[model samples]
Target: MTDSGIPVVFIHGLWLHASSWAPWLELFRENGYQPLAPGWPGIPDTVELARADPESIADKGIDDVTRHYAAVIDTLPRKPIIIGHSFGGMIAEKLLGENEGVAAIAIDAAQIKGVLPVPLSSLRATLPVFKNPANRHRAVSLTAEEFRYSFGNAVSPEESDELHRQWTIPAPGKPLFEAATANFSPHSPAAVHTENEERGPLLLIMGGQDHTVPEVITKSTLKQYRGSSAVTDLVEFPDRGHSLTVDSGWRAVADACLDWLRKQNL
Candidate 1:
């Protein structure tokens, strides 16, 4: 399983799995990049199956997910250029912090431990899981309405419904709980190594209309690494929402990412 070309690992966020990255894979391959999207451990192959059996990923924590992605990267002949959305974005940053990837892009990344500004919208977006203590040890599934509020607010109602049908899945709740208390936890996996000198170039992409991980949250995340020697930058799409990765305007976001990667010579 040795690969020669530059490998790109696409990480997906919650409520969606690796199959959601099919469009991204095609686009990257057309540009001569090798794209690999590994689903979170124990995730079902399809949204229907995942919705039917949510327990597979129940209780999975941030540490568990990171280690799963790290194992995949370890098998690659060259360090990859990692790109992720939402929680996947958080994982991308974690991987960069660990010096695993050559470069990384995180779109609407959830806040790491050190990022302190938690907006009301972010709180609301995660309320489905965080509001209930029992969710800490169980899997959680989003209703269509919840998905619309968290991810598809900026898209049309019809499109939102379609997107929900195509990509929504059950997600493990433990990671949400871990992230919610990251700052207080003595051994929080959500804590990032923003000051790691060996960290690779990193880009944090934000959607201005995103209720889940808004610009304020992303800015706070960027500010966390200001003193670090690693090249870190921020890019914001004003009209985009949390669904920026899979929305109709996804090409614009993807092209922006390509441009950034080109600038880095990654």
Candidate 2:
């Protein structure tokens, strides 16, 4: 079957290898869209290799990652529908606001500059990296227990361990540092053009139980887009956590996305 000519790009957040989007790619492809999942700059092609050489992905900040994905979008035949998780979701919003994508779905996205509420759970979820300032220029890996707390808390212990073993990878700490200090910086990379009225539609999905980016943060992110006249919507999965994109219930989230795209006639 021929593709619908519309592209769908999946952006995986930190701690998970880009291959985590494999199922999403297949699903979107079967639904008539051309889908691609590209890794961050310097990310190895495999989880094992990425785990082995964390330095390759170290020290990459938000701007660096955003530019990398923007370059990928430039290579596509049409402006793609961007779907991103965690920091990738932040990148998706930035890209969409800049007109790089036709539309975007930001699921459990990191807090942008204007987002003021930093829940205690969020602080705890990121403590592994924030505990040490020097980590900003390094790569950080989460232990299985930490992964369970931050990404898999809403799922079973066995499934969390399996997910940690299957897709976990060291992630750059620079972006976290940048996002943490966004409000203090005069020109922060974590700042999104939420007021871009000419930008494409946006969807913000929140995992109500997400420790890393709690529900309040997503709600704050929604408020950030209030100045814009563009399409902006929010959905909450109250029982889900940060692992929603790769968990057993991922299909439900993907199907919701597909339904939204169809509604937009994308």
Candidate 3:
């Protein structure tokens, strides 16, 4: 924790580690904001370490994972401006749902409870997991073509390949499955936001070309979020996919976030 009261906490989604926010860290720091990105429980301190032994990430479930982040926040002096991608975004919402004083930005957040209407694109994104139950503990890498299709469709071919090489890794199958079957669960993971009316300063960034969390899905989230006192903000970046955070034009998106933050004085 810095001398500054509450800083911006960047939470990375499954597969990629906290380092995925390196570029955004630079921009956020330049704007007088602090950046903190934490790893999932038992996750290696570095990317190389995690890639070498994917089996170490096996036992984390939604409850365990959410509690770990809550513990991290407990140590902070003030509530943070939580920015998350994919599953991390969902986790951010869950964190704010139970605890107040958080401002959040969910970038192409994976589907949560009330945010229904899963698209074929979302299911297709998880197709590799359906291959085997044992893969939950393994580190899987997406092929260039698969990465391009699932996350970087809007970026150039070379950029898409580079993005895949730089980030994409095997994520736990359990979380994906948990999110897929959230509606069926008695304790739905997606219900975090819809269940909390006091969630503060929420923003939903949807990629126009995103297949995973498509426009329809985001619309559903916006509709549910509209009922809250939290100042809801929505931004749609055209020609981007799920990889909007790491794609070549990632700075544009980051700038948009900062622009919003400046308005809110975060």
Candidate 4:
């Protein structure tokens, strides 16, 4: 495939290893884009190592992960198109706001500072981290049952278990803690530059059945960018859950993204 000279950066959210983006990277490359999926700071290169030494990623917060990706962008040949999921999605928005990317796609991103709706399911989904305040400074691993609830709820139990076995890893709790308290904090790392009118285009993708980040959260996120004249769009997958990006139907989601990028001429 001839190189398009366009870079696509994939950012994974909590509990999923960066390698989970393998399929997307291959697909994007075949379509002429240079795609890279980098692990979060302190993250091991592989899922096994990341699971074995969760402590290496403990205590890392949103700002830490954001800064890490920002540094990664600095090394790229050109400003990449940032595509992120969960917390990674929020980080992508922050990066785009700072003029780090040519555009961004935030898929089921975590809530930022201005979002106020906290759905009960969202609370239950994150109960693993919130149940113990100490988790804020530790790395927390989810059991298969918990993963089923949080990330695989909309998928078949069998497929859910398989996804858990393949990609689930311990994730830092600090980012969740920071997001939970963002609205109350004057200096929350969860804050994004939604007011930046000069930033590049942004697309917010939501999994309608997502227990972790419901559609309401994504809609609220869109509202935050209303004051800015920058291009911001929203798309929802009503039948999908948090696992949509890695599940069987992921190709559809990825195709939608590619279609959108083409529309933007990027």
Q: Which regions in candidate 3 have their CA more than 4 angstroms from the true location?
A: 136-139
lDDT at residue 95 of model 1 (Cα atoms):
94
CA lDDT, candidate 1, residue 20: 84
Indicate the residue-level lDDT of 182 in model 1.
Answer: 90
TM-score of 1: 0.97
lDDT of all the models against the reference? 0.90, 0.95, 0.78, 0.95
lDDT of 2 by residue, 99-194 (tens): 999999999999999999988999999999999999999999999999999999999999999999999999999999999999999899999999
- lDDT score for residue 153 of model 3: 81
Which regions of candidate 4 deviate over 4 angstroms? 1-4
Error of 4 at 193 (Å): 0.5
Per-residue lDDT tens digits for candidate 1, residues 96-211, read: 99999999999999889988888899889989998889998888888889989999999998898889888988898888888888989877999888999888899999999999
State how far residue 175 of model 1 sits from its true place (Å): 1.1
- Encode model 3's per-residue lDDT on 39-127: one tens digit a residue: 88778877787777777776566766788888887777788888888888888777777764468888888777766797888778777
Where's the lowest-lDDT run of ten residues in candidate 2?
1-10
Where in model 2 is the C-alpha error above 4 Å? 1-4
Q: Count the backbone clashes (under 3 Å) in each candidate.
A: 0, 0, 4, 0
Estimate TM-scores for all models.
0.97, 0.98, 0.93, 0.98
